[model samples]
Target: MRRRDFLRTAAVFVSGASVSLSALEFLDPGKVLAAHPQLRWAFLVDTHKCVGCGFCVKACKIENDIPLDANVTRTWVERYVIKKNGETVMDCPKGALDGYTSKLLDQGKSGKVLVPDKEVAQAFFVPKLCNHCELPACVQVCPVGATYQTADGAVLVDRQWCIGCGYCIMGCPYGVRFFHPVERVADKCTFCYHRISKGGNTACAQACPFGARRIGNLRDPDDPVAKTVLNQRVGVLRDEYGTKPHVFYLGLNKEVR
Candidate 1:
């Protein structure tokens, strides 16, 4: 069998391992923490290669059954354009579902966008989703024991148990969580839990044409992510909050949030 197919089969067996720790630090020093950190699956996003195509976003919606609304999103790409003067303008038109050229603009009284010209400093796309933090704030704030972190480092929710309090919504600093428009429950990315557990890649990663996104077991030294995290210049969002997120980025501009 192929490596990924084999890994998915392995994951199915490992899924039986109970992830009983509370949100983050609840696991003892050695319990849920893998003896080899690389054994756990991790996600990576190469911002430099993402073309704001919205393919990943659209694939995620179809794979996970997320209802599409202008405001609700499981994953979205932000297009950032920085001017020479250091002023930055950003927008994500319909989550860039149709790609990021000729994006929809909000024309106010002037009926024209006042954005900087294309001859600006730089531009790039940064995709956003639940970071599946090692110490997730969303799990900590869920009053109903609905939001949870899996043993394999995925942050998820028990939709049936979620009370729609939106507390987790407020607790997530990354702005990745939102109240589901139709379901009325708190919703966010789950790292494609269903497929990954069966050795399949998350839909977003599978759909990325440029190979900008990926998931891999950090423990396998041969896994590309294993070396990339150690050698590449990578960063995660909101490190100041001490989230210790598993998701990482490459070519992250200082202007991105």
Candidate 2:
């Protein structure tokens, strides 16, 4: 039988019990990669289009089984206000689930109160999530092999295998990883893998009225989102880390980190 097919059959029988870390080692992703050649999922964020409505944040929580009141989230949005003097203020209160209703921004690293609108030169919203890097440090730091990269380039955690050592959480440079309050395992965005794998859009993308968040198959030359990344100028957060993050941003501001 083909390797991919064999793994599928093995998974069926193994579903009755927890799969051990050593047993998972035999499932070479490289061999199974041939089963999916044209399915590299990519995500895009248009800063110019995002309105900070928090609809995407609410949708992600509902779709991913995250508690509505939980402080943690699979995705969140940040509001950035740049002052005329080049001072930047950012906030993501309640993960932007309530939207930016308050004119007063939180005192983040700046430790300063929100400046007056007259002093602000510009303002925009930035959405943040797991970058699903091509070279995922989280996967490498998982001592029990709980975190891994899929053939489609998604970084995922095997909750059953995870020992909750917190290594993967620390390994992430983007500070996206967090310990699930209930599951007690490392949790982060999966690019809505369960939905996207079924040929459906992510809840965040589907709920977005402004089309700020988008997803596409990078391997498909004709894919609109992929075409944008290929043809248009895009930016990524913390390129200095050399993680090769898959999430790209359009209209990325110099002040944004």
Candidate 3:
């Protein structure tokens, strides 16, 4: 049977949400290879294009069977406000599942005194995810070898083999890794491997109406996303770590970390 069709029939539920059992193939050893062996996957985020709508976060939860009310998520958006005095404030309320409507800074959220709009220099939203680095620290630190990177550059946690030791969580510089609330295994972004393998976009990318998020095969010369990455100036998080992150950002402000 076709992989997609078979996956549908093998639906499994986690935390009352239905997910395809086959979608977690990295858990099944010897099946961790990418569907498109020649493709090197990468992700792009346009900071200017993102509007803090949180649609991506909501769609990711539904597509991945993550509990809606869970405090953790595979992806999240952060709002950064730069004060005229050169101080920066960052906050992500409930992983930005609800759209950002508040213009005023919340002391409770940012752990600082509220700054009047007149004192704010600029504000923007940045989406965060597993960078799927070329040399992923999560994969390097997985004692049981539960965390690994697929050939196409997607990082996945083998839920069945994960010992819940939290080593991978601590190893990640991006602060993207977390223990699955239900499974208690190391969990992070998979780049929506299940959907991408079938020639579909990541749930977050698909749900984004503003064209803020995109994914593509970096090896494909004809791909628009790849061309953009090759031609345009893009920034990545924590470049000093030397993990060589695959996720790139356009119009990234210096205030961002």
Candidate of highest TM-score? 2
lDDT of model 3, residue 227? 95
TM-score list, all predictions: 0.82, 0.84, 0.83
Model 3 spans > 4 angstroms off? 1-37, 107-113
RMSD of each: 14.6, 13.5, 17.7
Q: Which residue pairs in model 1 clash with each other?
A: 8-199, 38-218, 38-219, 39-219
Query: Quick one: best lDDT, which candidate?
Result: 2
Regions of model 2 farther than 4 Å from truth:
1-36, 108-112
Worst 10 residues of 1 by lDDT: 103-112
List of clashing residue pairs for candidate 3 = none
Query: Against the true structure, candidate 1 has what lDDT?
Result: 0.83
Q: For model 3, what is the alpha-carbon lDDT of residue 190?
A: 95
Residue 142 alpha-carbon offset, candidate 1, angstroms: 0.9
Q: What is the alpha-carbon RMSD of candidate 1 to the true structure?
A: 14.6
Q: Which one wins by TM-score: 1 or 3?
A: 3
Task: Quote the lDDT for 202 in model 2.
Answer: 91
| lDDT against the true structure, each candidate | 0.83, 0.90, 0.89
- Give the least accurate 10-residue stretch of model 3, judged by summed lDDT: 28-37
